[model samples]
Target chain A: MDFTYDDEQEALRDAVRGLVGKAYHDYEQRRQAVKEDPGFSEQQWARLAEMGVLGLPFAEEDGGVGAGPTEIGIVCQELGRTIAPEPFLASVVLAGGLVSAAGTPEQRAEVLGALAAGERLLAFAHDEPGRRWGASAEQVTASADGDSWSLTGVKEPVPHGARADLLVVSAALPEGGTGLFLVQPDADGVTREGYATYDGGRAAKVAFDGAAATPLGEAGLDVTASIATVQDITRVMAGNQALGAMQTLLKATTDYLKTRKQFGVTLNTFQALNFRAADMYTSLELTHSLVAWATMVIAAGDPDEVAEAAARASLQVSRGGRHVGQEAIQLHGGIAMTAEYSVGMFVAHLTALDHLLGDGNHQVRVLSTKVADYDALDPLDV
Target chain B: MIEGRELTKEQIVEAQQTLNAAGLAVPHWPEEYGGRGWTDLQRHIWLEELQRAGVPTPLAFNASMIGPVIAHFGTEEQKKEFLPKTANLDIWWSQGFSEPDAGSDLASLRTTAVKDGDDWVVNGQKAWTTLGQFGDWIFTLVRTDPDVKKQAGISMLLIDMTSPGLEVRPVQLIDGSYEVNEVWFDDVRVPADNLVGELNGGWTIAKFLLGNERVGVAPVGSTKRILARAKDLAKETSDGEGGTLLDDPLVRARIVELENELLALELTALRVVAHSADGEPHPASSVLKLKGTELQQAVSELMVDLAGPASVASGAGDASDLAEWARISTPTYLNLRKASIYGGSNEIQRQIISRTILGL
Candidate 1:
């Protein structure tokens, strides 16, 4: 019932904000970091690990701090506020989340221990070239060769795929449903074509031609549901990240409106533009409410509820991100169109996040199918 | 009963007795004045539950608007004379803020009240006096001084609707309903004690009442109910192709979008209510009035669209075989247009958000 964060949560927010803000507070720092190959600061990633952020959502026995969803949300939001090019969402929340959710105790101990210590980077290679965002992997297939499993197929747009030391791949099992498997990027018969995405983030088209792999958990079992659930959780975190970016875009836009002038007056003198900024604020606030609620839903840890909440949050974030991102650039005029400014970069990151998991139309379809099952959605009922 | 527009005197009295006996009639007012001492969240839950159960809300003028003003600024004599009747609906109250010239710019109201010894002679007219036909009394904003600024010269007065030279003429709406009226005051006299607050202080009280009005005007619960009903209607109505209207992708998509928007609005309300402490309004309270009214109007529009051709039967009687819901869809859509118009129009809400919230 309470929306205000507790003292400890507030402290966590301040700590994360200080670290990310210190590193990427200046737009040039972020641009410089994304200009190169890995697309982020390795030193900053290690610092986050040192700060125990990468381990926020895992159990202590699994080499994580075992913090709750709200804490992870805090980190994601801070990262988003700066549009930090770090692969936290790609590596820690999504990839590390898949390993934690479907990995065996041994796998978790080995993989997460290294991940939390910043000794290794991980990427979840679930998206394929032809497949629209779906839980079950189709183009990627895994087969058993005696006691070892080998994966064959292509996973395109695998975020941080080439840079990741370890890959958590989703492949269709020979016996039945989709399963998670661990693969090495440098393994024989595996090739990665890494490129820069429009958002200044890194992605790779990974071709697995009978690449040696190990089952994430029990072999030949359907982890489709688990993958879907983890994706849902990731979707909620993505919402938090989008909220952070939108907040910054809105602030920057408003600040620009106050100071930026044309024809002897500041931009705020125009009611049309200021009104658009007001609408952006409205959209941000509504999205903020839903994102916060979805984080709590994840904290409650119910798969069905989490799935629905993630879709709702995704839908709102998708809509809000567009409104805020587009208007942010429009309100700032030519400066926003320049590569030197930060507003356009925020919009690019927002666009990337909007489609990372699922867009608004995707979410609407998901929700529409189940719209008949309930008369109303009561967030408090969760 | 669900409409709040169709409550009989007996039903209202019974509800007053039942709700007052349970101390639920006016849960947001001061405890000394029959409030239940509930938190803002609790009061929200109380009202939401009432709406969800198809129960008519306690009259807004009594439960939300003037009652709180009285509790905050009323003299002890005023409290003793008015609080109980206000809570129990023994005296129905109507709002008299908007004038023909002062719709959104309410402070520009020309209604004047001049002092004549122990009496204040009131003159001028008030427009859009909602539910004034059933009002036993009306709370008004009258111009008490001519020399000062428009806002500072105003005062709030409680006037008996039965007073001499007071006239209430029903104003027919586009929907053919008479839910609002124009009240003309011709030298009406009010006792000096009838003033709710200090002279030239009515603007502050009006602001307070309007803030309360915005918070309650969302009607999230009732809108949720109507949307749920729309889903049922969508299922029952056929699309002329063997499949139901719900089978149409576009129809279902629109419903889903509306539902999601309502969800966002409702959650924002909860967030605002949770953070609104010590009777101070949340900064995001403006969002509630702006988005809440839009969604409410959207749901009404959805019903009209769902009714399709059947919507034209808005005035049909029992002789027509069309479902009651279908017959009333268009009128409800027309009636709900007032949601964004009254209670501080949406444009004013945007202005507040831009100026006060965003510093635009």
Candidate 2:
């Protein structure tokens, strides 16, 4: 029920902010970082690992810090504030989370240990071409060859797939449901085509031609539900990230409105623009409430509730992100449209986050089917 | 007895008494004044349940508007005189803050109250005096000094509705409801002791009262009830297909989007209430007003749209074959347009956010 972070969480935020903010406070610094191949600073990644952020969500026995959802949310938020192009969300929260969720004891100790130590980067190569956002994979199929398993299909737009040292792949099993597999970058029959994304990040068209893979936890067992739960957790974390991005966009817009002069005065002197900014603030706060609530729901540890909370938070973030992002550009006029400006990149990042898990329409469509199941939503129900 | 019927004033008063007897009428007030000393969240649940169950909430002016202000700012003698009566609905209250020229710029009100020997002579017109016809007393904001700033020169006065030269004239609304009125005072005399707070200090009290108004003004519970009802209406309605209007993807999508927005708003209200547990209303309470009213009006619009052509039959009598809900849909929709306009127009809310919260 409490939304304010405790002192320890505040310290964690300050620490992450200090690190990321120092690295990317200047727009050009971030630009230079994204201009290269790895798409993010390796030193920064190692620094986050050194700070134990990359281990925030895993078990201590698996070489992690074993922090709760709130702490992880704070880290994601700080990273989002700077729009740091690192794969903390894609690697640590998503791919690492899948491994932590479905990996066997031995597997967790090895893969997550290396991930936490910053020895490896991971990607969840689940998304496929012509498919909308979902929990289970379709194009990718897993075949059981007596004692081993291999995956064959394409996982296009696999976030950071080419750069990832390890891949947590979701594939449809020959028998029935989806299963999680661990594939190495150099595994046989693996081809990765990495490219720059709209939001100054990397995704690859990874084609697995019967790629040698090991099961995440139990061999040939369906892990669809685990994958879905992990995705829900990732969605809530993404909401936290979007909340941070919107906060910065709002501040940047307000700062611009105060300094940018036209019509013989600053832009804020016009009530028309001020009112729009006010609406943007309203959007940000409302979305913030939902995102924070969803994070709390995740902490509460009910998968069903987490699923619902994630959808609600994702919807609000999508709508709010669009409003604040678009208005941030409009209020700043043409400057925000330039690549050199931080506001446009923040907007681009917000848009990317919006479409990452599920957009507003997607969330609403999922929600509409169950609208009749309840008379009204009660946030305090938990 | 009041569930489905058009409640008479006496019935409304009796309902408040029923709630007041249970100490549910003014749970936001101090415990000494019949309040339950409930948390904001509990009070929220109380309000939502009342709306969902079709129970008439305590009259806003008596229970929410002036009662809390009086309990907080009234002198011991004033509280002793009015608090019990206000809580029990023995004295129906009406608001007298708005003037024709002071609609949004409320501080510019021209109403004047001059000090007399043992009384104050009040003279001015107050517009938008809601439910004024039933008012046994009126809480007024009047100009007490011409030399000071408009806001600084104002004071709140508790005036008896029967005071000499005081008149209430009903103003029919677009929805054909005689809910609002214009109250005029021609040198009406009020006992000096009837002043609620310090003289020329009403602006602060006015702000406190207005802030209280906006805090609970979102109508989250009622809007939610109406939206749930809209879903039902959509189900019963035929789309000229094998299925009902609920079968329409667009209808369901609209309902879903509105439901999601309402969910967000409800959660926002909870967040606001939680933060306001310290007694001062949270600044983000403005979001509740702005978004709350928009959703309220939006749901009403959805009801009208669901009623379709039958919505035009708002004047239909009991003898008509059209569903009662359909006959009333358009009128309800038209009436709710005032949701955003009243309780400090949504525009004023944006202004509050821009100036106070955002520092824009």
DockQ of each: 0.73, 0.67
True contacts kept of each: 0.58, 0.61
Global local distance difference test of model 1? 0.89
Q: Write the per-residue lDDT of candidate 2 for residues B1-360, one digit (tens) a residue.
A: 211235679989988999988878899888888787777777877887887677888998888788889988999999999999999999999999999999989999999999989999999999999889999999999999989988999999999999999999999999898889999999999999999889999999998887676446677888877887888878878887778988787888898878778877877887787778567777778899899899999988998899888889978899999888888878778888998898788899899888888788
A1-382, model 2: which lDDT tens digit per residue? 8877899999999999999999999989999999988899999999988988888899999999999999999988988898999999999999999999999999999999999989999999998899999888899999988978899999988889989999999999888899999998898899999999988999999999999999999887888888888999999999989899999999998888888889889888999999999999989988888898899999999999999999989998999899999999998989998999999999999888888888999988888788767766777785
Where does the lowest 10-residue lDDT sum fall in candidate 2 chain A? A371-380
TM-score of chain A of 2: 0.99
Each prediction's whole-model lDDT (CA): 0.89, 0.89
Instruction: List, residue by residue over A267-350, the lDDT tens digit for candidate 1.
Output: 888888877887888899899988988999988888999999999999999998999999998888888999989999999999
Could you give the DockQ of candidate 2? 0.67
Off by over 4 Å in 2: B1-6
Question: Top DockQ: which candidate number?
Answer: 1
- Which stretches of model 1 miss by more than 4 angstroms? B2-5, B8-10
lDDT of 1 at B166: 99
Judging by lDDT against the true structure, name the best candidate. 1
